[model samples]
Target: MSLKYIDLFAGAGGLSEGFIRAGFEPIAHVEMNGDACDTLKTRTAFHYLNEKNQIEEYYNYLKGKITRNELWAKIPDNLINAVINTEISAETLPTIFEKIDSVLGKDKVDLVIGGPPCQAYSVAGRARDPKGMTEDPRNHLYKYYVEFLKRYKPKMFVFENVPGILSANNGGYLELIFEAVKEAGYELDKKVLNAKHFDVLQDRKRVIIIGWKKNLKLKYPHFEENEPQYEILKDLFSDLPKIKNGQGEWGAVDYAKETNNYLEKSGIRNGVCFTSQHIARPNNPNDLEIYKIAVNKWVQDNKRLNYAELPERLIKHNNTKSFTNRFQVVNHKGISHTVVAHICADGHYYIHPDIKQNRSITVREAARIQSFPDDYFFEKSRTTAFKQIGNAVPVLMAEGIANKIKEMIK
Candidate 1:
């Protein structure tokens, strides 16, 4: 039988996707956001259909030929019920337990994986709050995660978080978390892992803590870094059609060029000729000019344009002392910066490298940067999609971790 695992705080199943690709069976996915839940359900349906050789039903849904409800009808009820969509909290603990138990049956959870919302432990969150978000309710979520470890007693667990977590509350919070995990009868190891080292196109660093039952004698798996051999633009983006601001569709659109080795090998383009969510956001004239200037400076001079240095007329914000380097054009010659949830607010920080496009990277572009496959459908509006993509683990990075874990377990 396949190893079974539960994904707590699963955000659109990025980490879970990697595990699934490594042949683990997902017994349950617990999350809070309704839209993210819908996305989880959609992905669950896709996997079920794929297993049964009925992937055509999934393609039909992507092609706008069938409704999501119609597609779910093709999957087993147990498979669909496995996605538990409520928040993980003291108030919802019992109810969440009941939901997870319903699907668990006689199966033993082999692994538990997830990261709590990292906003409380992020540097940006600290800058915004007077107390550095130390008192934020999210800061205490590790207690709930410990509770899951106590309940499941899985052979192993993977805890992911931002690097700032080590410094949160002057590091007391992280210490307490480690104590809790140890007290639960497990030995743990943590390392700061970079997504780029795992073959992800962007540079994303996170705190990865792996814990195993004391009797298992497993230590942290050695993750070998596999750097990209191709340029970010040539391998990751050159094939997508160049649409102007506010141009392109949210659904399936034609690929600008044929698939390349990286696209196929990483499964980013996978069996699809046409891709979805390749649309660009509409930008105003002032922002457009600023975007062009930023792109030109980056592409031509290889220097970032300072927002405070823009022509006086184009400067809108009064506080010019900080955030001057806000507008960043994605570099064509290299990988992108970390894709963050902030992209949902504005594209100023994520301007496209293509001078002609002259806009922030689109929904699909952001997803590709995160290493999601072309056929991975994100439910809801483009803004919500960006949030999900930004908040997710790069599919490739997650898969690398999962593959190593599988080897360790075997």
Candidate 2:
């Protein structure tokens, strides 16, 4: 029998994509974000909640709103046949249970997989509040995940998040999650996975918590070590038409030349670079004029300077704790760093090497690095697009996990 799954907190359907590839049919998905829900609807044939406010009328309402054009235009035809959207929350587990009961009625879902928002435990966020408190309210949501597991009791589940959750407060949160899983009558195994090992060029590390009903005697699968080398920026994006900063085939644009130059000088090439404001000049302007001048002056003053000779002035300027510090470049040669939501605001870590500008990485390029196929349409607007990409699990990584899950299920 084909396995069936229900995805909670499904962001851009990364987890669902993996499950689908692994041969599990996605019956229902619950997400709060409208754009993400739209993307999900476009990609799969699963029943979805309507855009309406009322819960009972959601499915009917969506039937009218989801036309072939709207759905097909946003998602590839291959992935559109298996999605259902439910606008619900983990807090409303009873309602979700009722919906599932109506559809599947006595049939147990084979798998449940989700990654709740990690902002509370993210390493990139401020570690402490003004009172020097370390606790973030968002940290408590993991309990909700456990509650859902208790209510639905899927045969298996996967919980994903950043590595910081493992060592946060010296493993307190990790311990809490483990205890909750134990209490839920599931045998749990946790591992930190690097995306590069699973065909992602970027070096993103995430923690995956896998659990199955206590009666299963299956062992946790090991992540295979694969060859590190793969296609680089030149290989992946060489064929696409070049769009200068603030320009793209799908209404995407390029950054200023100055921004591009900065990234190029820093050894960044290919992929998108983000900028805070798109000040329309005759050309893309590098906003860091003063910093660039200072670096040049320092370099000129020391004629004997080598790569090591570049003064700390440039380093300080680059590392300054300001909005400009957000200027980042995503290197095309290796795996990308984690795609974060704030990446669009500044390119601190995501600059492009080819361009001589200080622009942030674009949503499309970010999605590409995350192993999203080129044809996966994103809702318009850079911010929304970036959020979708950032929140998505790397599709390739998900495929690898799916393969493992399939083996275990069989």
lDDT at residue 374 of model 2 (Cα atoms)? 42
The parts of candidate 2 lying over 4 Å away from their true place are 45-91, 126-135, 251-284, 288-325, 356-359
List lDDT for all candidates, in order: 0.89, 0.61
Q: What are the models' TM-scores?
A: 0.98, 0.74
Question: TM-score winner among the candidates?
Answer: 1
Candidate 1 versus truth, CA RMSD in Å, comes to: 1.0
Off by over 4 Å in 1: none
Clashes of 2: 64
**What TM-score does model 1 achieve against the real structure?**
0.98
Candidate 1 achieves a global lDDT of 0.89
Clash pairs, model 1 backbone = none
Q: Give RMSD to native, each candidate.
A: 1.0, 9.1
Model 2 residue 335 lDDT score: 52
